[model samples]
Target: MTCQRRIVSCLLVGISLGLLFTPALGREVSDIKPANPNLCPKGREILKYFQSIYGKRMLSGYNVYVHTPDDYEQTGMLAAIWGRDVQWLPPVDEVIAHVKAHGYLLTLHWHWFFGGDSAWKSKRKTPVNVARVVTPGTPEHATAMKEMAAAADILEKLQEAGIVVLWRPLHEIDGGWFWWTDLDRPENTAELWRMMFRFFTEERKLNNLIWVYSAGVGDLKKKPVELRKRFYPGAEYVDISGIDLYGVNPAEDEEPYWTFFRAMAEVSPGKMLALGECDELPNPQKLAAGRLPIWLYGLPWWGTPSARRPVEQAIATMRHPFVVTLDELPAFGDEDPPPVVGILSPMDDGSAWFPEGSVTVEGYAVDRRGKVVRLEFWANDQLVGQLANPPRQFRWQWTDAPSGCYDLRAVAIDDAGQRFRSNRIHVNVGVVDAARGRPVTASGGENPSAAVDGNYYTSWRAPTEAEEAWIMIDLGQVHSIHQVNLIWGWKIHAEHFAIETAKEAPSQAASWHRVYEGKNLPWEVWKATHRARFAPTEARYVRIHFFRRAARQTWGGYDLAAVEIPIPPSKGAE
Candidate 1:
């Protein structure tokens, strides 16, 4: 697609995913004489500024502005602009001139019909009930239309100046606390919007307005897309789509937003999505520019990084397409490079887990990109192990593991300070013994135990005949085994026993996968053995079970002496 098309697509996505809105109404603004489309010189300049930013791809570049004691000044830094008051209109010429000087557009903060500037100052939050706009000529409806016209008038000038206004009118209307709620009746909600559009466009003649709709996370529960469609002003009036979210840590709330976007995309895939505003910090690790490109409005709302410091970290982590700021909007396309000195193994480069196995690190080296590095292992102050560059997974011998918990640290150094140390990994190794022979039961009965050395350091047990019996074993490390021993008890009734291996914790018959079967043994023999040889596969659990008849001699039991798995050599195992 052309860049312009791509930008438009992105903007549309931003609109639907980022903001949601609903409204209410009163006076017949449609009947009142509409404002003439006369361009204000300052307004024209402002409109151009907004168009320069909102009309292009975020990948291109845009300027942001902030208010100052003197007239508005051009700020290189892109900052989040807030709208707290909307009682009386500002000096139109002054406000327009200030916005023009700083290259900033007016961002209207909309509230409910019953909620005037006073209510906003008191609550400092948008009122929730926004669907009441179509309440049939109510006083609240009249107040809403009047506010819409006034706000539209400001936007009209901004639009005339070629600066697009981020018109956030009647936001958070999905929440029940606001008088404009449309949760129960979405159609009426849509009607209220028709009234709003008529008042703003037909009466106020505000063509440069980029209608921003907003809703909270709760409103999504009722169906964000349905809510949007029921009240959205179609493609002509809406310039951007966004959502209002807060207090949700990106670390924790990231998934829900992803889900919400996936659903929203399905409903309105063509709108640009953005985080209209936030009263809390979002997780940077979880948010990538491609998945959810958002403009964080509030800075360091809360949390660990000192209020101001988190913003720096947030800025560091946020890449292009994702902008973070509180005071000034920075120029785009000047992102710094990724960290050079870092852990290479643990391969922070990309995800490593496969469908089949889990990773248990021996150790790894951290270093700069494209450099030969050496790793040193440390436990408290003691040196333990080391590895050179190009090495990823490290394996520790079962015997070398310490008895108690010890921190496993890996630090990398190409030359000097270019080193990274992994957070310590606690390792506690325990030992287990291997048993000899096929664990065979001496007699076929309810239960039987097979023995090796009377010392019982390593032994095997058999299953019962009443139903079916099984024995399980765990192989500590990832090893390949060629042979397995199984001993049958006197109740040698089944035609064969099935052997299986698995990687999960063994529970009542839950962890084993069938691998081998053994022929039935004659009853005369006190014990019988079974063996199997196969290519090596890493498994922690080994299980054996009678595959045929449950019991041979009695109704209530069966037996086995033991099940043993011989470990494979490490060198050629993988």
Candidate 2:
């Protein structure tokens, strides 16, 4: 027999033996035991104690939510973070496959609307009132019941699949943008709560569903406990309570973000705690340094190592310990369908004043048949944008783009013309500024140089305590930068580098803060030895001073990758 056939036969035989032997094989099935008495309602406070200890140590059996097929395909075991897409449709089968493959317990995020946008609800962009649901006689109230029924259907499906759903719906109800939030009457919030509970429990009869209450990280006073009092509906309905805090400041003066979580924990301790939704919240300088084309709050791409500190600290230690890690599970896929990769377009950097003439995208499609296909570009995943001329460099002019961040992608078509998408590329197309000129490579040692990636170019160099690299940065606008990171290339002796910030004009009083003082010790590239928090300041000058190289260090030189700056905290965002 072929090796593949033999492998499949072995798997089938192993599963059959494991199932038939049951208890003898260390497998327990066909039994139901009562959940822990301390589980959500009765032992709320006790649960909190467990979580605190659990958060500090690694967790054993919880699952991170994986929303998209790519989520499982792209990540590894030790990544620790998992996410599920907040889709409007039911994903029961997909969730089950995820659990079976990843071994992490699942949470079915009950997204309130499509794409997390209230504007696309049954009524487009129309403001819906949660209080109206309490009116038994109103049509709006009846409509709300129907929507709740749809949600109940989803719960029923999950239960039938033997899945424990982490039912987190109408999250951030304190925010005015959602359909479930009641900003006017705190009492009205309770009406909506009881409605959902009744739909899921009484109608759907989904006992396996675990209710997870989520809120924003902003001031609780604004949301007010008075509204949440009636909001709980009852302890029988909730299994976990968590708050989503995207606060950016690590400053001691600011109201601690964890204080909000502690309040929620105090109120409902029996359930599991989760981050719900989080990302690296950027302060002002980091935001500017990113040079994002839009004013969106969070970074759209992957989070960098330099930017993850605050995200780590916010969830630093959990209180009640139901923990989950990605590594404990086996590979997500072994013999599943082959992956299709595509490339996105608009490769020009954001600074381009005009569009590049023409852009082409190339994608290679390989399937289970091991067949290759040349695909065409489809806009909005639909209409064929182009027939795709060739497999080489696809170029598009700048003026042709809509002058914004456009999603560029390509697909591969089989000999049968079947198309599969390639990996996506984010294209930042914008007008180039006349005054903003690229920095010249000031004198640098032979080690560091400037290089270009696609449209934008970056320079990295080193300086010594005796020789400092003076690089100029023009903000284009007046702003303050509170935090700055000087990239020290991967060297055990990186502590030899120190960073100092100064004002652009020496005439303007000497406003300089020695942000970092390197430690004279051997360390790895990933280790951070020097760190400091500084008051927000407006300055255009930054100086890098290196005192000494690592003792017995090879190369006997300085290294740098890229400098990162975090934006100062926005007034309310912090």
Candidate 3:
């Protein structure tokens, strides 16, 4: 049978068996809901606690900008501090213990100036090639490991104190301003990310951490798809998807804020999303009225005498009915029982045909009071694989399985010695076909189609002599665009460009409006990718206008190796 026919047959069989496996797709903001409690009980509990008060109250969080340990008592808000602040504060253990004693929900953010003590030496001068610091077997890697080990020691102290921490490290990496920005080695950033995950989870054996993957809005504006694709450490490594914004004008930027939030949720489904760091708090009225995605939490940067808001305003926002403060938080130890665990994937009774000799079994487990200790995958009542101290998402590979039907289920065991089993799924070993999405259409370029052809080596280039040119794409139908990525060609480059959109085909007299403009973009052949973000704008057409090419010794033209536009999933979408 043809691939289409086989897919149809599979679907029919799936339907008859009362098991339908829809491919993972984007999600709409309205579809946002609490993740399965069995996936990350502690994380889920925290999220559920916030969700219970979502439309009624907002949580108050404060960063340790200076050495003000008393700030927690003064404001009665959740406590957030920087890892680097350990340089000037009391011992890490002492600080965390004191905060816990005060009953504050604690979180940590790391600026992580890899090569040096600070992110900058002066105003704009940052250490270069910091990406190499995370690459293995290098002198920089050695230094990085030593420094990280010291930091791990501090975190170990927290683990010993039984303090569950919302740990966000190497944040805002997509922006070029930070030292740890992967600009120098963008291709290797994923490796660097995995290295950190392994270090923190395996080497340090830190169990009190809830890892948060965070990026900056500035970077999201430049390369939305690539920024997330390149830097995302994967769902298994991240507990929360976070974004940092400073000096935000909420009235003007609300759409962009929601766009980013929706995009984060789409890319990392089942992971709680948070406003990891922000300078200005969003409107409390909007937050209480459910005008925004139910964020897990909001944390503001440290307030100094030089740039601080009235303590009254902070206090009021925290006291908002939707906000949850430390004092209002529910007790978790004995009052909260061990969470019930359930698998989220390989749907109960669902089946997959894989004649490729291998299949990946994946799912998640959560507990409200205790941490998940292990996840075991069983096939035909025999253990196939297991993960220890796994993240919410767990995966195990079954290789060289004999061609036949088999029963599979996953068992989760938590730290409290409570065990939960997933519903059994059936698998059939057979040939499987790959799935692809609809192709994109572009207006102008030597090979306009190449940009969306999924081949990174091939590119679409405007005529060599064309000083001004434009490329437009049809997304099939109108979509709420949150982010756009422009991957530059290896040799040819553009120094300036403008991104515009419209409900109809773009033209000077049409309804097209510029959403983002690029100026003096850094020139690095094949190394530079620009991402642009705007408030969610509904558009069927997107256009990029290139005005000037960068000065180069070789060919002169505007060229892009690839382009990607990621939209949020519609309501009821998979």
RMSD, every candidate, angstroms: 22.2, 20.4, 25.2
Encode model 3's per-residue lDDT on 398-429: one tens digit a residue.
78676444556777777867666664554544
TM-score of 1: 0.39
State the lDDT at 545 in candidate 3. Answer: 84
Alpha-carbon TM-score of each model against the true structure: 0.39, 0.41, 0.48
Candidate number that wins on lDDT, 1 or 2: 1
Q: What is the lDDT of residue 232 in candidate 2?
A: 53
What lDDT is reached at residue 434 by model 2?
16
Per-structure clash totals for the candidates: 80, 55, 27
lDDT of 3 at 111: 58
lDDT of each: 0.43, 0.42, 0.58
Descending-lDDT candidate ranking: 3, 1, 2
Judging by TM-score, tell me the better candidate of 1 and 3.
Answer: 3
What ranges in model 1 sit over 4 Å off?
A: 1-76, 80-94, 112-140, 157-162, 219-237, 251-253, 280-311, 314-574
On residues 1-574, what C-alpha lDDT tens digit does candidate 2 reach at each position?
Answer: 2223323543554454345432111011112121323223312332333343332222322123211112211111122333343454436677666554333444555556622245323454666666676788877788777766766766666566555555667665555555666767745765677677766666666676556677655656765554554455445555555555564353221234335545555544444445455443222222122211101111111222224332222222111111222322222213222223333222222222233323444322333333434445543344336543343223333235443233355554544444555533433333222113323243355323231111122324444432334333333344455544443433423546655666555335466667666556565442122333367665555445555556534444454433334342231111
Q: Which stretches of candidate 3 lie over 4 Å from their true place?
A: 1-57, 67-89, 121-131, 219-221, 250-253, 304-308, 334-574
